[model samples]
Every structure is written in C-alpha cells, then in structure tokens.
Target: MTERLLAFLILCLVAGAPFGAALMWTGNLILDFVFFYPLFMSGLWTFGGLYYWLHWERFWPWSPDAPPPTLKGTPWISILIPCHNEAEHGADTVLSALNQRYPHVEVIAIDDGSTDDTGAMLDRLADTHARLRVIHLARNQGKAMALRMGALAARSEYLVCIDGDAILHRDAAVYLAAPLVDHPRVGAVTGNPRVRTRSTLIGRVQVGEFSSIVGLIKRTQRVYGQVFTVSGVVAAFRRGALDRVGYWSLDMVTEDIDISWKLQRDHWSIFFEPRALCWILMPETLRGLWKQRLRWAQGGAEVFLKNLPGIRAWRHRRLWPMALEYCVSTIWAFALALSMALWTTGLFVALPGHIQVETLMPPAFTGMALAAACLLQFCISVFIDHRYEHGLFRALYWVIWYPLAYWLIGLLTTLYGFPRVMLRRHRARARWNSPDRGIKAPTS
Candidate 1:
C-alpha cells in the first residue's frame, strides 16, 4: 500500500513536469506529439491502470463470476506443453508443471516433430511419471496444431498451457484454475511471466519490460473488460472455450492472438491473474529478440487485417477498442522511429546546416518531462512486481535506454512484420528453430 502511494507520488511529479513545461508554451505541435503527448498518455494510462487494479475489489466489487471459495473439492487440470526442438528445456517445463501445488494434476507434453532430443527428453520424463502423457507428432506442425493435438489428448475439463521454455511457480496451476471454477463465463486466464534469463543486458531489461509495461497494460485492459492478447508464455483456458472457438488457428503466425480474438468473439471473458507466475527464458541477442517480436507484431497485424471490417459491427464492438489500440500504438512506434531517424541524420547536418541542438533533441523542458514520465511508469511497475525481482533495482541505471532503443526496435518490427503478413500469398509454415535461450550454464 505504501508503495502504491509512492508510485502515485512519482506520477504526480511526472505530471507536474509537463504542465510546468506548458508554462513556457512554445506552441509546437510536433514537439507536443513527439514528447508531451506520449508523456501525458503514459501518466494517464499508468495511473488509471493502477487505480483499477489496486481498488478493483472495492469499486467493481462484484465480478460476474462467483468467488473461488464457493467451488467444490479438487478439480483435474491438464498442463498442456507444446514443444519443438526445445530439447532438455522441454523436460524442465514438464517437471515444473508436474510439481504444481494443485492436486490431481497431469501433464500432456507434445513433441511437435523435433529433430533434436526434445522427444527423447519427454519420453524419459514420462517413463518415471505415470500422469505425464507424451505425444510425438510424426511431422513438424505449428504451435496451434501442437496445442490442438495436446488438447485432444487431455482428459481434463480445465487446461493450463505454458511455453516449453517456462518453469511454472509451485502454486500457479492452483491459482490459475480459480477463475474457471468460480466464474460462469470465464474462458481464459493469462498468467504473469517473469524472465529467467538475466545473463545479459537485453535479458535484464526485458524483466522490467514484462513487469512494468506488459503487466501493467494487461491489468488495465482487464479492468476495461478487454485485452489485446494473452501472453503465450503462460495461460489457462477452459476446454469448453477452446471448443467454442474451434481451437487454435493453424495459419495465423501467432496462435495465441488468433485464439484470443476467437474466444472473445464467442462472448467468453478472459482474466489476468498476476499471482499465476511462470518464469521463462528469453532471447538475449538483438537478432533473436527481433525475430520473436516481428513474429508477434506480424501476427497481431494479420489478426487485425482479418477482423478490420467486423470491428464496427455491434456483435464485434468489443474488438473495436483493441483494434484501435493496435493502430494507435503502431502509429506511435513509427512516429518515434521517424523522430529518431531525423535526429541521426541531422547530426551530420547540425553544425553545417545551422540546426540548433534544441531542434535536434526534444526541448530541455519536454525531454525532462518525458524522462520523468517513463521513470514514474517503470517505478510503479517494478514496485508491483518487486517480489519477483532479479537484480531488478540494480538494473535501474540502464532503464533510460528503453525509450530510445525499444521504440525504434518496435517501429522496425512493425514495419517488417505488417508487410510480411500483408504481401505473403502462402500459408504460414510450421517450421521454426529453437529460440535463443541465452548463455545458460548446464546444471547437473
């Protein structure tokens, strides 16, 4: 509670900076759009988001679905793990799922035609655990198909899906299943994902990204009764929801986004459970991270393109908000990138072309305001997720790098991905190599 107040205080200070700058009033639209607008939206969204979650129970005290206490004894939950060339990492995930605190839990591990040792690892784990079911596809299929196969093999009504690279918290399954049994129309529960790879700067920064930006936005959207997409790392679903949505899409680049839209279209509500934690590995190199994000951005675009026309329909009104959010975010990314590009090229032309440094950078006042806003957002986010801290505070000095670097990266990804999806004539292929798992040291 004290931390929440501190976050609020920081936001207030950040807000003051912009209004303080407004006293100087240059009347520059570009300056306002590039700097002030982002800062303003950041504070508005962050504060509003925090307010909803912090007092979620009080203001909107009653959820349409009942509380977990009303539910009966232990229910069966199948942990469906889809893998492809994940190797030993797949086994680690299976072990984590089987170790859940929940009673009557089973694991359905699918080896999606991996050329590597992932299949063998699943077999080895299944050999010792009777409840762990292993399904090996003869051919390589997409994640959507692998999940579909695993879902078919699963006997339980409730399903928990985690990436093959993830390690579930001991109580994750138990907490994730609560919404399903407690609520009437709850179809899916998105879990909190923590980064396990902290060996590099990129990895460490992503920890802040997930907790601060991704997690905060999720909580905010959940309060608004809609979410852009569920994190693919760890999510829980009622088997009935999957059935209603016709399962996952084999052609969509991102099965998670595609399926999420499909479920909501069917009138099933999704929930975000922060207590349901799953730690997972992430790409440490720029190249690897770029590939991962591009696939995500592109998948989002594909989904948007498919549903663009339907967004205005009364039946699909819920989708209009998400679609608009994506469009606005995309525009923001491009604008940020263009601003950076002009800065870079202007460096060569600055002194020679007689452009002042003030023109090159955001006005001193606006720059300070933007920086404060970002810091405030990060502080609030990191505070909420401090319990999962991994060198989190120590990594604070590096936080400033995010706004400049990630924005451009997001711009490039969106540019590359959106076109790839739009121009492609063929179906999305099922082929994918193993994701970079960072420089992980082997544990005996």
Candidate 2:
C-alpha cells in the first residue's frame, strides 16, 4: 500500500511538471491554473508528509532498560564543562555533573577566563565535591581550546563534553557511557536534549520543535550511523577516537558537527540514544532565537564548504548522503517560500474575463493538503511531547504557527548565514556562552 501510494505521488509529480511547462509555454490560462502552482505546493507538502511518516516510529523515546551492552572492567569517564562568563550557572552545571549516578566518573570544569565569578565559583565547587576538578585559563580561550585542554587532562577512557548551562539527567552519564562499553566501533553517543524552561510562548514553541527534531530526524539518522551533530549540550566520545582525529578543531563555530563528520569519515560509528536525555534552556525571545539559529546555520554552511572536497569524495556514501539530504531539505523550504510569494503576486494580476473559481480549486486543495500535513506533524509533536505540562493543546497551537514561523526564520537565517559563511565570519567564536542558570526564574 505504501509503495503504491508513493508511486502514485511520483507519477503525479512527473506528469504535472511537463503539463506545467506546456501551460507556461502556450500561455493557456486554464492549463496554467490547473497544473503548475497546485502541483508545486503538493510536491512540497507531500515530501514533508512522507518524511514524517517514514520516521514516525521514532516519535517516542525508547524504554529505559534497553541498555547498551556492558563491558568487563569499569571504564573511567571524564565529564568536561567549558565555561565562559557563566558564573551564574557554572556551579549548578558542575553540581549536576557531580550528582551523576555513575560510579566511575570525574567532573572537570574549565573556566575559560570568564570575567564573571565563574572561576571562583568553580574553585568553591571543586573544594566541596571530592571528584570535581577545576581548570582556569589565563586568558579567554574559545570553547574548542578549552575542550581540548580539558580532554587532554582527562584520565578516563571516555570524555563527555557538556555545556556549562546544561544539566544532565541523573542517569544520562551512564546511558552515554553504555554505548562505548561494548560497541568498540562506536566513537560517540548523542543524548536527546530538551528545553528546560518552556514558560514563554517562544520557549514553548521551541520545545515542540526540539522534540520533533530529535525524536524523529535524529533517530532516523541514527539508524544509518550517520547522525550529524552530536549536540554539544551532552555527548560522549571515546578519547582515542577523538585523539585519532587530532582533537577538536578550533576553526569552525560548530566543532561538534565538524568532529562528527570527521569521525564518520574515519569510519567511526556514532549513536543517538533518545532515552538518554538532558535538559537545557532555549532562547526565550524571537530575537535571541534568530541569533542562535543564524549562528547554527552559518556554522553548518562553513562546515559544508570547508569539507566540500571530502564530501564529494564520499558522495553516495553514508555521511555524504545525509549531508546532501539536509542541503536539499533546507533548499526546498526556501524554494516553497519563494514560490508562495510568486503565486501571491500572480493572484493580483488576472488576465481577463470569464474567470472560473473552479479553475483555482487545485491550488486551494493544495493549500488544504499542506495544512493537513502540518496538522499531522503537529499530532506527532503532541503525541511525542505531550507528557510535559499543557503539552497536547500547546503542541496543536504551535503546529499551526510553527511552519510559517519556522520557514520565515529559516529563510532569514539561511540568507544571513550564506554571506557569513562566504566571508568566514564567526558569530560565537567557537566559544561557549554560559546560559543564565539561576534556578529557573519564577515565571509568574
């Protein structure tokens, strides 16, 4: 049934393309009305729907007991926290690591010359926690440099890099380490990160977005061992595998993504464990979110461009295919936005008499289809994330507004990111900014 439906959709697209081309050539109003615009929109929505359907199984977190295979000896794990002006949250992040349920773990907090009381706070935390260690840099080195220093100082077999603002679940460390215990080929494990504070509208919307993204897309990527970005929020890596790639590269803004690609190129398996969760705060305002996404998009483009040669060499290969898939997906969103703009303009300039509303039915139906697609996506989001407070109805509302807002934001970021990528501009400077971790400020 799925294959037949897929084939039918393909035929519709293939047949519609030439019809659209012929209508444009002949300047036939009826054919133009019947074919091009509607088909275009349908194609976009269909692609989205198909993608969601294909990965729908990942919408829920796996059962907790589905543990990674065990190892013979206890492996010492080092937790590296790179802090920059995060005095406000550094202590809490360190404390969270110290509170990990894992028995064989070492907590190392590197204060990247923070101007704030971050260094002092870490000093105090280190004194309190026997397993906690602190490293203070003489100057403000970027996160990549700080991570390198910390990783080098690590005496463990596995190193986990976590942001200063991120708080790991009690079992997160153990879950992260489990993969490496048995899968000798697995170089890294990525944890599912959730937005900690969803008080504001912006925060709530982002919560939904993050849930669907990690729950669906990242999990699908995991199936092929092609997970792209092992988020810096909470990810574990084999020290040897990282050392083999010569440690984290400081040139790019997304060191996480860069390292992931390098690891894949080196034939190292990367796993995404949806059950291994960490909670971190997301940008709470549209402006803040824009800046954050701009940085990410720009960083991604930089990685793509810088590694173009290697990507080309590995075309048709695993990571390369995933990379291309991402690129195409990004481009399609922008294209759909552009096409909508064009269609709206065309609607204003009508060519004369006996206009039939029925002639416009296809485009209208296409719009409805797109809306339904969004609705289905929303359903998935709510189903997966409905465990949190107000999750169901809020997810519905977000689904309604998300596509428009997401594409607009994506378009702006893609436009903003391109030039920066071409000019080699670094927004965050490969450094980590400590988020405000003061006990989630009273929302009321």
Candidate 3:
C-alpha cells in the first residue's frame, strides 16, 4: 500500500509539471498540447503506414493465404502454446498448429497449472500426434515462465509462440520463420492478429482496432527502425536471440514488451510480418475489455520504468524517439485528465480568467483538423490491410468509434497504471490469472 501511495505521489508530480508551467506560461499551451499530440501521432502513423505499403508491403511476392517461397532446406521450427485454464479452446488451437502447411514443425503445449482439465486434454492430444509434446507445470506459473521452459526445451532454432486460444493460420508458421531463416540479424517476427469474436459490438470494434491502430503502429515503428513491442498473442523468435537476452523476464507483468526492448537494446532486429496471420478471441464486454486494457497499460508502464535508466547511453540513441514519445503520452494523459477535472469544477464554480472553460475543447477548426487526420489514418490502414482482413470494409462503421475509444481508454489506463508501476517491487515470479477470452459460439 505504501508503494501505491508513492506511485500516486509521483503521478501527481508528473501531472503537475504542466500545471506548474501554466503559472509561468499561459494555460492555453497545456490545452493546445493535449489537443495536438494525438493529431500529430495520427498523422505520423498514417504517413508511416503509407510509406511501408508503397516501399515494402505491396511488393511482397508470396500470397497472404499461401505458403511463403520454399527455402533450400526446411529447417525445423517449434510452436509454443502456453495455457492457463484454456480447456474450451485448447484442442482446436493445438490442431491448427499441428496442421501448419510447413512440413518440419513440432508443437509444444504447456499447461500452466490449470485447475481445469487443460493438462489432461493436452496429454490426450499428444497421444495421437507424434510431433506434439505436452509439458505440465505442478502449479500455476505465469506465461513468461511457461514460455521460458518451452523455449529451453524446444528442439529447433526457430520458435513461434501463440496464446492457448489463438488459431494459427495454416501458412503462418512458414511466414513467421522465414524472416529468421533468411536474415541472420532478425531476432523476432510479430504476426497479424485478426479478431474472431465478433458476436458483440466491442469485439467487432477491436477487429478494426487491430488493423487501424495496432497493425499500423507496428508498420510505422518498423519503418522508424525500432518496434515498441511485438504482438504477445503470436510472435516468432530466434532461439539464439532469446538465449542472448536471457529469454523473457519472468518478473514482468507483460513479458512481450520487456523482451522486445531486451532484443532491440542488444542490437537484434525485430520484424513485422503481415502475412503471418493468427486468429484470436478478444473481450466482448466492457468489464472484460477494461481489465484486459488495464493489464496492457500496466505492462507498458512497467517496461518503460524498467528501461528508463539505459536510454542515456550513446549506443542506445535509436531508442530515444520511442522513449520520448512514451513520456509525452504519459504526460498528455495526465494533462487531459486535469483538464476534465478543472472543466467539471468550472461547471459548479468559476475558474480563473486564464483558465477559461472553452479551453477544455479544441476550437472548431482544430477539431476538424484532428478529425481529418484520424480519418486519413483509418482509411489508409484499413485499405492496406483489407486483403488480410476479409470483409474489412463492413467494419468501417464500427471503426468510427475507435478513435474516441482509444483516446478515452488510453487516458484512463495511463492515469491508473503509471503510479502503481512506479511504487511496485519486482516479484519472484509473475503469476497468471486467466483473462476474458471473449464468448465462443456454441459448437454442435
């Protein structure tokens, strides 16, 4: 609790930085920053995505749905599925991995001390398939530890890790491992995650979120020469790279972000592979969505805080852009939050002359500019990804809610997560509590 208190205190200091400057400068500057940062980021991502498409993605020779060009010799690869109470989706997920079009692949399923029949079911699947192996943990260890064990036991140089509930595309294995096999310096390849839980409005919007926001940002980051993080749900790694970085940090709440930083800091390259598609479920309800996003926000904060000390080095110069962006975004979250609070207080009581209530929102012209930028970004990202996402245009209506959803969600999560991350001590092992994997349709 003391840790939490310190975290809150630190957050107040960080948030207060803008307001403190308001006394020297005008409060208008803070409001302008709050309004313009999102607009600027949207524009950057749109242009970056367009650049990647024109120069890189559009010219790829292989079909998205077919196997990539065959190599001289098919090197062996291992698919790692770490599960925690995933009985309902385990079998189908394993089957998809086993059925990969790539010929030389082995499937390893780790049942991370599931209370349900997850272990028994994995064993049952292993009995029928010679290439499938099952590892049972005596108790619940987190996803990072489970993955660490699986990677250590993997018999191949290339490894693809997916969530227990995700269905890997038939040709995903080859597309993922191809980068590692072809490029000696490439450390990891993050795949495209398509949402399969579209039974609800929230789930439907996330599908577009993956394309417009998640997918676009990755392409942009890769173009910038550093990735913020790999898609944790499905990413392929080079065993040598993992070994060098000491594998995933067991203490991190989000291992993906931590490992991404580790590899990049060590001068290993991470690639974004659009053809390696993985279908996965997402939260269909608001409560579930909030929990999932909260965890993600906390994980991001943890990574930022843990890696804060290393950025001063001259050799880590490439990481400065990403680090500065994170700092600005965190400060922006607090500034926006403060603006809302002051605006609400103004409704009941008058605020000072310098802090006019009208400043709470962008002027009509600025609003239009932001809207135009967001629309361009959405259009470009969705258009580029349309081939990978069938019937994607139909989701355009749902995506209209995306910009607002992301803004509000991003603001709240950062405010709530940053402090907790600041005060928290590292744990011996990060524990896993099963997440909301969305509502699966009934299978007759």
Candidate 2 per-residue lDDT over residues 320-414, each given as its tens digit: 75777556544543444334444554577763233212232345655677667666655665565454323446456764676567756766787
By TM-score rank, best first, the candidates go 3, 1, 2
Per-model TM-score versus the true fold: 0.84, 0.78, 0.95
Candidate 3: tens digits of C-alpha lDDT, residues 1-444: 655565566567677876775555556777888899999999989999899999999998655555466844789989999999999998999999999988899999999999999998999999999999999999998999999889988999999999999988888988899989999999999999889888888988998899999988999999999999999999999999999999999888889999999999999999999988899988989999999899889999888866766777999999989888888899899888877776788788977866644448687888999999988887898889987866888898998789899999999898898876786665457888877877863221
Model 2 spans > 4 angstroms off: 1-71, 314-316, 333-362, 381-395, 425-429, 432-444
- Considering every candidate listed, which one attains the maximal lDDT? 3
Per-residue lDDT over 1-444 for candidate 1, one digit per residue giving the tens place of the 0 to 100 score: 543454344334433333333344432433456566567666865785687667762343222132322235678889999998888677778888998756689999989989989888889889999999999999888788889999999988889999998988877786788899888699999998888787788887777778767887888788777777888889989999899879988888888888888888888899988777788888889988988888888888778766665566798887777777777666555554444544566667653222222353677888888888889888877666665554567767666567676666777887677656655556656555677787762221
TM-score of 3: 0.95
Alpha-carbon lDDT, every model: 0.75, 0.68, 0.87
Q: Assess candidate 1 and give its TM-score to the true structure.
A: 0.84
Candidate numbers, best lDDT first, in rank order? 3, 1, 2
Clashes of 1: 0
Model 3's lDDT to the true fold?
A: 0.87
RMSD of each: 9.6, 8.5, 2.5
Q: CA shift at 14, candidate 2, in angstroms? A: 23
